[model samples]
Target: MIDVYLLSGFLGSGKTSLLSHIIEQFKKEGTKPAVIMNELGKLPFDSRAVEADVPLKEMLEGCICCTGSEKMEAQLQMLLEGESFDVLLIETTGAAHPVEAMDAVYSPLFASKLNMKGIITVADCKRWLDRDKMTPQTRMLFLEQIRHAHLIVANKIDLLTDSEIATVTMQLQALNAKAPIIQTSNSKLPLNIMKKIEATFHEKEINETAIGKQLFLSSRLHTFQEPVNQEDFECWLKELPDTVYRMKGYVPLVGHKNPLLFQYAYGMVQWLPEMIKMPPQIVIIGDQVDRIDVLGRISND
Candidate 1:
């Protein structure tokens, strides 16, 4: 399986800058890394962010968790099936929730296609403190991104002082105690720290993931289970709120021997015949999603 890393942060949090450093470090080590950038608007900002020579793909015209989720799956498949690489990195939009965007990889279409590493969220130590004053939507989205990530990269520390940096670290630590937080300036960090990241799905924490937190797994687990009503499943998916940026799951249909596949783009729903060997598990990564209720509905349906 391929190792996929999701990079997210608020506006000007220096996600692209940090990602650029990662790619450069890999090149220095003679490793090739593939990158995917999600453009929420028509302009491809991330495409121009890189200075080094590297193979990259950009998904434009939508947020990775919003309009371009399907395209994300397609682009990722193309890279793994058509191209060759050692690692997969995704740089999410400043406005999009990173967790929801990362959830796009949860399909059976990508189960064997690639392996996902922990999420990397870059927090601008200086900007994060005043985020509440800049805008509420951004504040909410940034908080959501921080909650779901397995690694918190407290970047842009150059602009902050000793006390300010300490405050931000304490706040993030209070919010999430499990994930380790790293300090960086313009993405300048040790490669060994990132290489140490395990690319496996940890179900206990993932199943308990909040809708806003992006899903970061630590293992590869697949299963098969009983049938569910296709109609109710669709309804449930459609009823989800806009904050639900991404949702993915595997379910057996009533009549077919194959599993009835499920993947959602926030409120958008899609189902198809899945021949892959997958379990009854579904992973929902988005903004403000009800994990237990969603799991219960899938099981009852």
Candidate 2:
């Protein structure tokens, strides 16, 4: 049976960074790691972070929970049939509810071929400190992500002051007393820390109170026709409502030949230069987003 680990975390909480670390560790140990990356839009951005040689499958256009269970079963079957790997990692979308994601993976058709290693959740330390700013639904989503993990990674601690880090640690411990919490910058997990997660005999634990499909979130995709002035684009970002949780993709900026990878989460934004040309498009995800209005604004300028 292939070992299966479900990587769960809130939007922009360093799930992808942890994924890279896990892949590297498995490679060093001579174990092949296969990945199933889920995205809420037609164009996938995070999957690009995975190496080219690893076996990977992308589930786009919906959350694993929102997408039909049969769809997940089919993807698992395809991977099982086509790949030769020791471990499989399923990276759920940021908007996904943990209970719903867990339910999707426990399909009876493929359950026996897989060993359900516990959930590994990455929590953003600064996000937890400022979670009060999030919508009620989003706050609950963040809580649920931590509640169900077997291993909790408190990421981005470097940004927090000593007092803030202490507060965040206490809060996470209160929320999840059962899981081991590790603090790290950039979601770096030591090889031994993974062993602590692996040593956990994870049985399928589904919290009945989990807010499954009730969390209403939506995503919109917009492609840019012309390079955008950085100053003007950032000014528009201020106009977006706080309900807009995540926005990530490649953007063609003035004076740059290649598109820069842009990510925005909870009032924070980042841009990374890209060496090769990429499609200039962005996917915006949020709770009850004004898609019509937001899309119109994005399409213009």
**Model 1 per-residue lDDT tens digits across residues 117-177:** 7777777777677665533444566677777777889887777899999999999988767
Q: Model 1: what TM-score?
A: 0.65
Report the Cα lDDT for candidate 2: 0.83
The sequence of per-residue lDDT tens digits that candidate 2 reaches over residues 264-284 is: 986788999999999999998
TM-score of each: 0.65, 0.91
* Residue 245 displacement in candidate 2 (angstroms): 1.5
* Residue 49 lDDT, candidate 2, scale 0-100: 79
The model with the greatest lDDT is 2
